[model samples]
Target: MGTAQAAQAAQTTQTAQTAQAAQTTQSAQAPQTANAADPGMEQAPIAYVGGMPPVMDHMIYSHALLDEFEARADGHGGQFRYDGQAWFGTDYDKLWLKSEGTVGTDGRFGDGDHEALYDHAISRYFDVQSGVRVDLDNGPTRAWGAVGVEGLALYFFQLEATTYFSDRGAAARLQGSYDLLLTNRLILQPQVEMNVYSTNDRARGNGRGLSDIDTGLRLRYEWHRKIAPYLGVTYTSSFDQAASMARTRGRQVHALTVTAGLRLWF
Candidate 1:
């Protein structure tokens, strides 16, 4: 009987050791299984370092209306001219600069209108801008307050309209343009612009109401997206008192010009 009891106790001790070994192995694997099931180990979105936005969030663009390179008999005998605009910032906010005019053969630039403005987007496709305008020509060098809206219309048309108030008088301007693709690299563009005044500035040969209209059609082959050479025709006409005023100054009320120019951006 004594031998049998000793044998039974030995058997019980071996079974308990086996059970402990199994428990120990399971405990060793517990952390690894928990990590495999953890939600924190899943894929995550990219995190911006140093709490800063991406670099490509801002943009800059510019273009020039290199008009009048080849012009017909206009007001002043022979002149070189350029009209350009550039802006910098995000799509919703920007600083804008625009200038257009002519420099005579005598190496002087007098006929021009320029502005510097702050642009604020009021909608996805529209911005309201306010700034100052400076006019130079046969008239006095005048400075004016400018307010305007510029944006896209009808999904593609680019449009801008501005009103000006100055010590001399009030004025408004409208500019619009549309682009048509003739080929993958060839494009046709048409533009129209108008100027109106509340009062006539005889010194500047401007009418009290509708002063002038400028219309142009251009065809361009873009050698590259950043640069294009264009050839176009421009028609400028003066009306009412403005036309009579130009005649008095020995200038024609209408001028037709051929335009050749390069439009570039960086």
Candidate 2:
């Protein structure tokens, strides 16, 4: 072909190519541009409401069990151990404010012992607990203090340590527990508690300042919608300064307790 003819043909081809490119671009973006009004959804922008209703539920129960044992020196003195517990909770957002406490009576029908467990959850599975207990000792009042993190991995395991202070002296205990689910209605909880006492308290002959070994198995069966019957057998013994006091007051005493109680929740 002639130079002028070839130039004309090339220009025509270029024009056709440009038109095709423009059409392809428009086709590719048409659906998106048209759907801008609907945004491919029929719902409006939803903002999570900032408020949730507070949950209020509380339970009160009493347990009547035989509390009898033989001390090395005291020997064959039996008393009934009665315990009562109650809890109240208020939840806001993700925080739960709770106050729970227990009161127990000795066999002699004297002033009962009491302890309160304070718990606040900053987030799911992370909570702080403060515990204080007062005993019926004739002298200065007995109290306990504790602060720890719970649920490091999951809700099945917990670690906590407590320091006890009283007119007599001071002591500390570190405890860890793991809950194993055996069935829908049954669970096994294994716990380890280590006790330590200050020199002054140990010297004063405080029973709890010495070392203690407690290993136990606890099982619960739900009998009603809000109540469960629980049983536990624990092997408990004391050592060191506490053990020495027990021996002088009374051998290393070994005893086992079989506890049957009702656990109720609302």
Candidate 3:
């Protein structure tokens, strides 16, 4: 009777152990089953849909630069000069307005060049510009159709070359400048400009072929990125018949001047 009782007790213990093992396995599988059946438990899909951010590449912008506004002393007298430009548009296309000129102590203004141009980007660092240029001052006003290319050259030199045509004659101009940093806020700049003509305009003191050249070196201290004060020396001269015309009018063919100016941009 004792042996039968012990065997029945062992069988009961075995049945309980089997039932607990089954319960544990079912508990482990319950979560997986729920995840498969419940739609909220699924991971969200990655896809490009209607809700996305906009790009700024097509946005418009504008800028203006007053490169030089200076007073010059050439021993004989004092003169005032100005060079500036403004542009409005997007990254690829723009409208450019440029003006530069000189005013003499004798209250005479000359060499005034103003332009309204359409600029198109053709390469990474260059632009092609086409438009009208008006020569206005104390002399006879002349109008011309102008085309030009301007950009950074090799070694980061700023350069511009433009040609003009009108009923009076054909003309071309080349301008270049370079900046050498002396310090974080100090710089030295060298600039040059040359003009040529196909016909003479005696009334305007212009001659055929190579007409005039202007070159200068300036040292500036930048109080701010948008403004600077500079001091420089400039040499301006006429060549060939232009020199003769200048001499005939009792004007110096060549003059060296000291300049003090401000450079501004925004």
Candidate number of the best TM-score: 3
Worst 10 residues of 3 by lDDT: 46-55
lDDT of 3 at 204: 89
lDDT of each: 0.82, 0.53, 0.94
lDDT tens digits, residues 187-250, model 2? 6666565667665343323454456665556676655636666677656577766777767756
Segments in model 3 whose C-alpha atoms lie over 4 Å from true places? 1-53
Candidate with the larger lDDT of 1 and 3:
3
Candidate that beats the other on lDDT, 2 or 3, i.e. the better one? 3
In model 1, where is the ten-residue run with the lowest total lDDT?
63-72
Any idea what lDDT model 1 has?
Answer: 0.82
- Give the best candidate by lDDT: 3
Clashing pairs in 2: 72-250, 73-250
The TM-score, computed over Cα atoms with residue i paired to residue i, of candidate 1 is: 0.74
Q: What range of 10 consecutive residues in model 2 has the weakest lDDT sum? A: 65-74
Candidate 1 lDDT, 1-266, residue by residue in tens: 69999999999999999999999999999998999899898788778987776776356644344332333334456556677777776776788888888776667765689899999999988999999999976557889999999999995899999999987889999999988999988999899999999998887777989999989898988889877888888888899999998888877688787777776665
| Residue pair clashes in candidate 3 | none
Cα lDDT tens digits, model 3, 119-226, are 999999999999999999998999999999999999999999999999987999999999999998899999999999999999889999999999999999998999
- Full ranking by lDDT: 3, 1, 2
